[model samples]
Target: MACRCSPLLLPLLGWSALLLAPMLLVQFANAAIFVDDRGVQHTWDESTKARVAVRAGIGAVSLYHMGMREEQLAATWGLWGVRGSDFDPENPSQGSIYPEADPSPEEAAFLASAVNLSPSCWKNPRGCFQWDDTAEVLGMRDEIDFIVNIDNGSAEDSYNAAEEAGMNVIFIDTFYEYNENCRASNYSIIDTSFCYGRSMIDVAQRIEELAVFLGVEVDQNSLNQQKQAACDAAQAFTETMKDLHDKGIRVKVSIVDTELRDDTGVTTASVADFDPIELWVPRTLEELGMPLLHAASYENNEYGYIYSDEYFPDCTPGFVNDTCNGNTYFPVDFWLIDSRSFILIDDNFKLIFPDRAMLAGQYWSYPRNDGSISYVMIESLLNEYRTRLGSAVKLQDSTGTCTPADPKATAHLVADGTGGLGLNEFICYDEAAIQQEYLQCPTVAPVPPVSTPTSPTPPTANPPVPTSPNTSASSDAIMVSTITSIAAAAVTAFLMFCSTSG
Candidate 1:
């Protein structure tokens, strides 16, 4: 796909003190807390909350590459202000930005103020950078922290580039692409990959980070408590999986998303010997057997950004790494052991999160569509399991039998065939569509055996010889008759000549 970044050509400025380190902050009050220049505790405000809500991640990547837009940022802040009560990421058919949508003027003003931290990044035409390896484009920025180093195409090159840039570089190859030189974190680093496993928690921390950097301590006890709660949710989810297995209902993880893997430059997976920061998740179904879904690639080194790889078959190339906007990308290297897609079966024991369009990140893709994110809080995902216990009817096959072509078929869900969510919109997961996807046909009927031909008669070679003898006699008789006729004709010709002369 075509990705562009800030390409302004300017002289490099000396590096500034490393921007706020996330570790300097601690948790408090079960909420986000960060330390500021003044050493005071700070919490996320409405505007900060809004910005962090829609962001899959917050960092140098989006700022440098990925073409992050001001309007989308503003919309995210607006949407964040109305999560849950005012908005539902799970159900998009309802709500607006205000009473639903249209954030209040004061809220709008705050979002605007909060969002313009790097007006220079947007205002300067020179800072726009587009990376298409072979593209003959030369551009630079003035006074940046990181210096980029070049290697033909290796992970070491990325590290070397980061080292040369004089800035701390966290390789997020799973989520976003760093500058080829690996120098700066402008727009490209501003991805929301971090929001995948940890939703509200990331929101709180990201907001606090922004508030502190813009001018700010975020709560230590609160955030600590939240993390603990998140861990609890993870534990609860695993237990629920055990219960489901008892009921013969199972969760088969289809595909692990791209951001859920390690950097292409590093190894695909971690080993006892090394810690690899790729793969967006922790302990996948393949590595650890939880009710968690596992992933298989559409092709070697390629995967669907969508909920399942099956959708990859349906996808046509667009942007987002030449993939269909199923939100699939390179598996992110970092993943939480506990984080998962909330799409699951209801206690009724039927499918819940079945379709890619209804899955998380539907609106938030790399090419960056106008879709908004729903706050699938840790609690909501946990609730999905709790809500599904003994709830749904025994799922039936497409033929209406409990034993579908696939024994795993619990039920069937059909798509409304609406195809996709509207522009800048996302429709919730369609259970019917998901159910329909599982129903399969049993074995095909066997064809009748082919009849064998009887062996050819031994030529009745004698019969063939008898027919040849007759043929030889007929030919001799014909030749003799022809000679006799010729002789008779000559005699008649002489008589005729004599008659004519007389």
Candidate 2:
């Protein structure tokens, strides 16, 4: 009457459940999504179908001046950061020094001489004063993330517009043009032409007089106020741009003898009170401590002196070396936008570090008065960086598809080759692109469905007739019981016999 048990059934049911549970867990984990504090979400290959896309942008100076409408600016330069100065109520157009309808012969003569002597001077006199025209003629409006205007009065408004459009802006100090007489042409109210007409010492004394007239502290009987005025004007400009800090825009100044504080009243300690120093001058290859170098046009051959070379040897034109030998403090604001500065570094990097490094910078960033060599230089540099760096990060590119030659390393991206270029030295973008591409590519092999094993069919239920059993079940039980009883009785009898014998 005892129930018969089937041992195979228990194991079959338990193992089937165990295997199924793990499959379900894995599928659930694969389906989950996570996001970061910045609102950037992480997506796995399986979940990235509709969400994955590219970002494109540009970097230009005075972006609005490029004839790009607010919407166009947004579409082209939206992803980069915002910068530049606000339009000045005092001088609208952000210190844009356009030539008056006509200038005195003396003034025109000085400007002509400067244009001829200064390497940066435009071949055409009228072309230099036309920002909008330059932008149109150069076809720059269509290219760039945002624009950075140096000592531009309209920098803030331009930056705000850029921010709204999702672009970045930069404010360069006037120091880059301080030594250039053309600055007076750009800012005619400065009376630089008259000052330059005198002896250098007399000019210096006149400058001191002007600074005193402006109510700024100056050396007793010294005429260095021109320098002081330029510095003060720059400091004021920086302060004005710094107001946008709360809104997330960046402002920067350049290194100039004026910006360098000999005035004990405004020492380096107080310098931090204003805008943050953008670039540290005296940049040396040995001191960069970085694997990649970003070069602008002026950094190219013979044009290298436009940028500070205190840490490099031979600050002279066309001479490229590492480190500036002198110990003067150099500010790095304008260097970021100076096209000439990039050219020198570009050639230097190519010649020396071709195996490991590359350079990138803005193309068509400003309204180029002369279009002679920018396009050719830009393409050459781009190709050079790509070929040399192989695969490295291009911080400026939005596509993020740019990859290195080697599949294992990172590559740089240039979102819009028109506006800016970035040196992704760590190959950050290359590695990311590879991972993304790998995850995105469809598998060639077909995935087979998981098969559930079935239990083998048991024998038919028909009872087998007693082939040789001889009706054993009925008699077998009775015989087994009888044998058990007899064994027990014999044991009892033995114990009794032992007791009697004792």
Candidate 3:
């Protein structure tokens, strides 16, 4: 049966599953399971360790869900693995997989075995595996309750041996069974999105499934808490987008594989609601034209051909390693794409600093064509815009993906320094005009005089320093440009995936 949840769920409960024995239930109700060094007996068994792991699992699951919520927010600007990113805690696929151990050892030992992973997946599945190989080799495979996975070869032979020894063999292929649906994010009872961030409902159902398999029952209140947390997160995420909308910083997004349709690697909806670019996506096969770069593709030194050594040097371990350089790293192949692009899906997007935010020493900061030195992170950009423009930069109202409906079809939004901004459909984009406006930013101090009154005396005049970037070389005009700046050759957008040993 589907788990029913209450709205007031939070402060998630941390507890072991309630054993389904009627005597155990009576003991729970009567408080009869404890002793004080008296003649009373305490429940002490190797299996009882799963209880401790179960408690820790609650915390791990909560962190994983929170990471998922954060991802939904970050996807707003298409900044997944770049610009101060946080990887999902449950699914350790993003940057550093070394320190992050999601599944508690107890859970790892309870119900599963690890095998040699698919050859394509580095023999280690990121974004996909529930447990890392370390836990598997650490004796987790020695303690399964029942219902273990089966394979056709050596793994199958072992399974047969175990079954002959009176162990029940239950066949399950969860990885392949739910992989496609999970990737597509068709969240439902049957097929749920896995590692990226399992939803509350998804987690609850999973709990129930595990309970059935283990012949245990979960606390209904705990189930409700999980569900409630999901709803609350969804509500909070929606409000975040709405806040962006009122401030006017929402950009519409229409994600596309740039190389497939055009070799130029840039195609436009020609819509102005978003200054969409040609997104750069690394791929395994250039002929297949697949843009989504999976962890599997990076195995076997293939990804290095696309991304340069300067970008993703052999010295740097993770796809991104800030300890080495603050810059986001991808195979050098990402640099060749014509333009960085995205269709803003909603203003509800946000950039979040995860629990590890404090650990991060630095994020990439650099000068842009806009003549401002700023951190390239999404939150940093949004904060800067809000501080300077009095309102967040917003996309023109866009209804959907088609030109008329898409954010791209709409006019570009331009803010007038007089506490106001407007959409410009007639003019494509006035970059120079915008730069000129930045020079006179009311929020950024005050506008400088077009020309200091030509002093009557040279010594007293204090001639303007030519080095000042705010001033022009040929002309003395203080006008700003609304035109878009030149974008990087390609975007560093990437989606990570992982798979467990079958």
Candidate 4:
């Protein structure tokens, strides 16, 4: 049927069509139909794809989602950045992860670019797992183009709602089963192999798949190369550690979370309660031919819970009673007497264990479970072992105190400083003391700040000193571009609407 417009409105309609043409063309170009890994077909609009929300059961998965993104803006769910008491004890939500409550320029730029969902989630009843109001409270249901759901159990309803709302849902691992490497062990925590190995590989593959779904071209070769390089490095580190063990140089180490202690000592709370030795620490150490000190000495199957007089023969009756009741401090002194070195997860142990054991290093200065696992973490652990084994010296005489104040101890503590115990703890290698050509003990370079990422990108073999970019200018440019686009669209729509009306 032919429809006729008023003679006066004909010119207006023509102008309106002309104005809408460019925007319509842009929208049409961005629209696509593709199938996700789940085999479900989806139609995507470019406007919707610009914003993404990740709802993964595990923190690692959420981090992988963001790290894999080339340019898409992600809604950050978990905490990222430094350790220390940045938050108020009474009000947990009013905290910043940055040191001195200020983000470094680089961090500020990154945070500005991403959407932080953490604050909103913190106020919610169920936190990040809340599904019913997730879309509304996160401000994501209408704002986001896609919801990356990893079958975290609580998000099924949210995922369904999103799909119904015409939002593209990228569902990965519907059943959400851990890989065999993680599940094979009866450890309290997921195996480190799964953390750095299988999980990363899966994420990498899914990232490539996501790119295809979005019609975005990624450098597959470059990603593959990075993956291979990381794997090779891990393998080499393991092999080197094993070789060191074959040489009869046993490096006994323990992983402890000192933050769990109240006045008593390693309390049975949160991460402190579990024995990391039972997980990857001992397994990896054993594989590397290093002796597991705690496992070897303590006969009890449960390492954290020190029950029965058989484990603590020297304790008084009151001490024994407290030990059996799980109120006693972790037997740090007993463990460290034989074991010369240990790795701490928290900074609280500086005073307690300093006189007992030499601090080898600290791990996850920024929370470990919050998606901090990476190939670089594995490399860092191996490096710590290498440094400790090569540089360890006996500063304590029969009296068990640092007499004569070893210069090397001060130098090592200062160099590797991650809130390390004061200089009086243990002796380490100086330039003259280090016999190994590869060992770079007592380094003169300033130690990295405590706020450094847990799994920072490993420096190149001969790394050049890095220079910071003009992040402020870069951020300004992005803002300007976004504003310009919005203004242009707004003006164009208004002009077209005014011209079309009769």
Candidate 5:
């Protein structure tokens, strides 16, 4: 131990010691000492930290309410065991009581192997405070070192029961109450008006705090980056929509529940059917500078009526009278059908507004609240706008077209070959029969009137050739060829002049 080193090695050893000091400090920092709500302190090294188990109800509801952020983070980091159940909406109590009926094998295995802190409740003939039975049912009674409970009337009994069973209890109500108080103090009246419940941001912040309380290391930087990316995508989409609007290429869209079709197959569901918080799609579009048709009128309607109950008694709300007040709100450039609706409703909408486009699928589903608007959803919306609006612009530039006809004047219900009445006749700019029937055709008097006349009829016997949009590609190639030839000739002449001078 007393062996001497050379003078040259002394500096190298000192430098090595300086470099290793922070590494040793980090190793020591990784050992966490967490204090539970009961004033009980627990220590764990890096290898044997406590395992977490989220209640089954929390996992089920968080999917639609909080975007499943907590579950996703836990699964990705392998820090927690998730309890899942086969949810039955008709009999909701079955899911909360049963642990063996879990549908996901992966989740079940995680719960069985890694659960040491149980934050769950069970119901019986008595009530929901049976913590010992819940722990035994979840197969975590032997291994569970702590029981986390909410400090509310609903969970106070459960906390006492767990403590009576000789287990430490940690109350999580302070985290939730703190966030609620912060929101009340900081949020403006308008901001509070938009909020339906605890927002995704609140959920995320609470999760981060809970992780710290449980001595779990979370990738907070990565989570913030993901959230920032989503906000950036939403902002980019808004800017794109603003640019399109400035170019006078406004795409009017209407959200309809096609499931509520009338006898004549016309959609009876209007903006009145949905609550203010559920109208996230229209609200987001309006925020992005793209106002949806009839949304404002419906929002501001004095009587809060959008459709008549005379024709659609089954679908209309009970407050509606027998008068059609919102017949003029149907015409729009495109329709966004509710995801719950039938696919055949597309035909019904086409018969009513013949020139309009439609997009359907789960992405266009109803109840589009704050939790539903993710980064992927924003990207999808941007793609739809680009595809639909780009095609319309290209078509209009090539073909001199007018605005679609008034739906009220053109659309009519006619008797089908069968005994039923169906939506049959509608006028559109593309329809040849409607064009000939009108004294002034849309081709003759194009909407947003173009300066160049694009009439097929001319004074000469031989009509002039019509220019197709495809010709631009060939024209560009020809111009490139001409420029290349001129450049080659100029270069050759300059070389000849130099040779002659020499």
Candidate 6:
């Protein structure tokens, strides 16, 4: 007969096994370990004295899920020459060879030179990693005090590395991961939909979860609570980080736009109900006690492309529905407007200095891998602006990629003006280039009075009752022409896409 186990122990053993599985997984998963000064140990090490170099990994869902493989990450940092311990059990591709020192002198000099220009802020403030890694390849470690993993790796791994290196973290909250539209934001855990991606509703939820994970226990409430319990929890968490904050391990949580939580009914609107952007502004102003560095995309057509009646004919129909004639009826690109508006309102808060309200040039600021180019000519234009402005202007390159501020202390701006005095600083070139573009634009100029030949009859004391319906008719006709052109463009676009796809 086969050996038989006790039936009574079956349930007990099963329950014990269920509990042990998570414990075992936790132990195995605790690749990064930390210890405080008193010898207290923590599963994920987040406290350290070494500076952090945050890297935004490339935009690949598969890569993101797999986490940061060692060899892949090593290639990113050029670890072939750098000698150090290679302990990555997860990825075998990592090389044992390591650089004895930092990047080459030429690269360090290049980074040093690049940091002086503004608008070349941090690489991908959102979550794209290519730009982030490029900064490291160029030897920004000497300049950047900390390398917070924007999308450098999984949150756990990133925190672990930061702790191991003794660097602070700039934890960009993920709204879609816990929002009602969790499934909808399929591409990125954090939506890249401007204001929608950074709304407070999503932010509040994300912050609460992050706080709990960071080993804090603030009171939280259900999602639908009329009062903002999530916001409170976030505020509490930020306050609690004070302990680590005192240790010089500061954490900054940012929302790219203010209107993220507002109900704008646009694609860029956040699915979360909380208004974290709005809540963050005042608190960031009052509680954080640090001058808020508010950045926003300006008003313009998507990608700053002039897709007029010339490019997209099908857009005409959409334009027709909005106006009497199609001229002024172009679609507002609500999503773009809302995102820009969110940041614009923040600029309106006079307390925020002009430098703080750095105007992000266009919505799609960076070059897309799929052949999309940046709206503004960054290199040539900014260089010209810097040359013209003299000492009155300061530019800070945000890691020579897509951040709003430079890593070095220099002002990272192409061109900036004095306070609300309505002064416009030139970023591209002298007044001539701007004037030429202004002239070429489609905006109608004010029509001046025509000096027509006088009739033989002397003018009556009161001018004969003017009976020119032509002016009104012309205005109406212009409007109609504009509307028709836009509608035609949009319809043409739709049909073209369909035909091409099919």
Best by lDDT: 4
Tens-digit per-residue lDDT, 333-380, candidate 3 = 111111112212112111111101112211112111111011111123
Q: Write the per-residue lDDT of candidate 4 for residues 32-84, one digit (tens) a residue.
A: 76554445666776344355665322332333322444245465443343223
Estimate every model's Cα lDDT from 0 to 1: 0.27, 0.25, 0.23, 0.38, 0.35, 0.26
Rank ordering of all candidates by lDDT, starting from the highest: 4, 5, 1, 6, 2, 3
TM per candidate:
0.29, 0.18, 0.26, 0.42, 0.35, 0.21
lDDT for each residue of candidate 2 in 375-423, tens digit (9 for 90 to 100): 1122222233223223222222122222123212211111111111223
The sequence of per-residue lDDT tens digits that candidate 1 reaches over residues 1-502 is: 3323222311111011111111121121124444321122344332232222122122222221122223323211112222212323223345433231223333333334323323222222122121222111111212221122111122344333433554322222222122233323332322222211212222223433443332223244443444455455544554554454344342322222222333233212110110111121211111111222223323332333442232233343221112343332222111211112121212211111123322222211011111111112333334443444324221211111111121111111001111111111211222232211112212333456899988986655445344345775565566555555555565555555545652
Instruction: Name the regions of candidate 2 deviating beyond 4 angstroms.
Output: 1-154, 158-290, 293-338, 343-384, 389-502
Please, what are the lDDT tens digits per residue for candidate 5 over residues 439-482?
12112222475588777865898877866666755655565555
Weakest lDDT window of 10 consecutive positions for candidate 1: 269-278
How far out, in Å, is residue 59 in model 4? Answer: 7.6
Q: Model 1: residues >4 Å from true position, as ranges?
A: 1-112, 116-216, 253-289, 293-298, 304-377, 385-502
Q: For candidate 5, give the lDDT of residue 449.
A: 52
Alpha-carbon deviation at 305 in model 5, angstroms: 6.6
In terms of lDDT, which candidate is stronger, 5 or 6?
A: 5
Error of 2 at 330 (Å): 16
Which regions of candidate 3 are displaced past 4 Å? 1-143, 147-200, 245-502
Clash statistics: count for each candidate: 112, 82, 47, 1, 0, 64
